[model samples]
Target: MDDATRIELEAATFRRLVAHLRERTDVQNIDLMNLAGFCRNCLSKWYRAAAEERGLGLDDATAREIIYGMPYAEWKDRYQREASAEQQAAFVEAIRKPDA
Candidate 1:
């Protein structure tokens, strides 16, 4: 595929992933971190950084709003849950694993 086509496909995939995450309200950020070592917050931060790299003045809240499909605080209030001990332990262990 041409570079432009590849970029378009990647962008579309990213949008789909974000949309899926937005719909998966039962999935918490901590759970994502424990399983994948990243979450919506990480994606938001990446979005913010990308914006800043392109000279846009995107802030964290707005970035998170894009990823979450709503304001972060509101989403947290509505769906965020306290991480369980097991989840926290797994997250720690996951973080400690050396990348191969």
Candidate 2:
């Protein structure tokens, strides 16, 4: 409940989420974006932003590698799929939703 404990718990949760996403390669980013309003790339961006806030000098590629558990281009080549029309439409709708 103290600040340090809260930070540790949040960091552990983030690591677990990243690990889960790494294990679930079949879950495409587009599907995540369509369904959840965010994706691995969003997480990568957030990670990079956090690093910048801490003066850690993390770049996009490094942030993406951390999030993807590998080089992003390699992950994309191996696991990423083209979004279906339905998926794209859903993503657009999700983005436009007031609460999203």
Candidate 3:
């Protein structure tokens, strides 16, 4: 594939992933951290970093709004749940690993 086509495909895939995550609000960030080692906040940070690479200024709030489809605080108020002890332990264990 051409470089342009590859970039387009990758962008499309990213959009799909973001859309999926937006729709799956029941899936908490800690769950994502435990299973995939990243979460929506990670995506927001990556998005902000990418904009910086292009000489664009994007703040955390804007990047998170783009990812969450709302202000981060609003999303947290509406959908985020308190992590269970099991989830917190898993997150701690996951981060303690060398590869994680």
In the range 1-100, model 2's lDDT, one tens digit per residue, is: 8999999999999999999999999999999888778899999999999889998999999999999999999999999888889988988888888982
Model 3 earns a TM-score of 0.98
Q: What is the C-alpha lDDT of each candidate?
A: 0.95, 0.93, 0.98
> Model 3, 12: alpha-carbon shift in Å?
0.4
Residue 19, model 3: Cα distance from true site in angstroms: 0.3
The estimated TM-scores of all candidates read 0.95, 0.94, 0.98
- Over 1-100, each residue of candidate 3 has an lDDT whose tens digit, in order, gives 9999999999999999999999999999999999999999999999999999999999999999999999999999999999999999999999889972
Per-residue lDDT for 1-100 in model 1, tens only?
A: 9999999999999999999999999999999988888999999999999999999999999999999999998999999999999988999899899985
Model 2 Cα RMSD, Å? Answer: 1.1
Query: Which ranges of candidate 2 are over 4 A from the true structure?
Result: none
- TM-score between candidate 1 and the true structure: 0.95
lDDT of 2 at 92: 86
- Select the stronger candidate by lDDT from 1 and 3: 3
Backbone N/Cα/C clashes per model: 0, 0, 0
| TM-score-better candidate, 1 vs 3 | 3
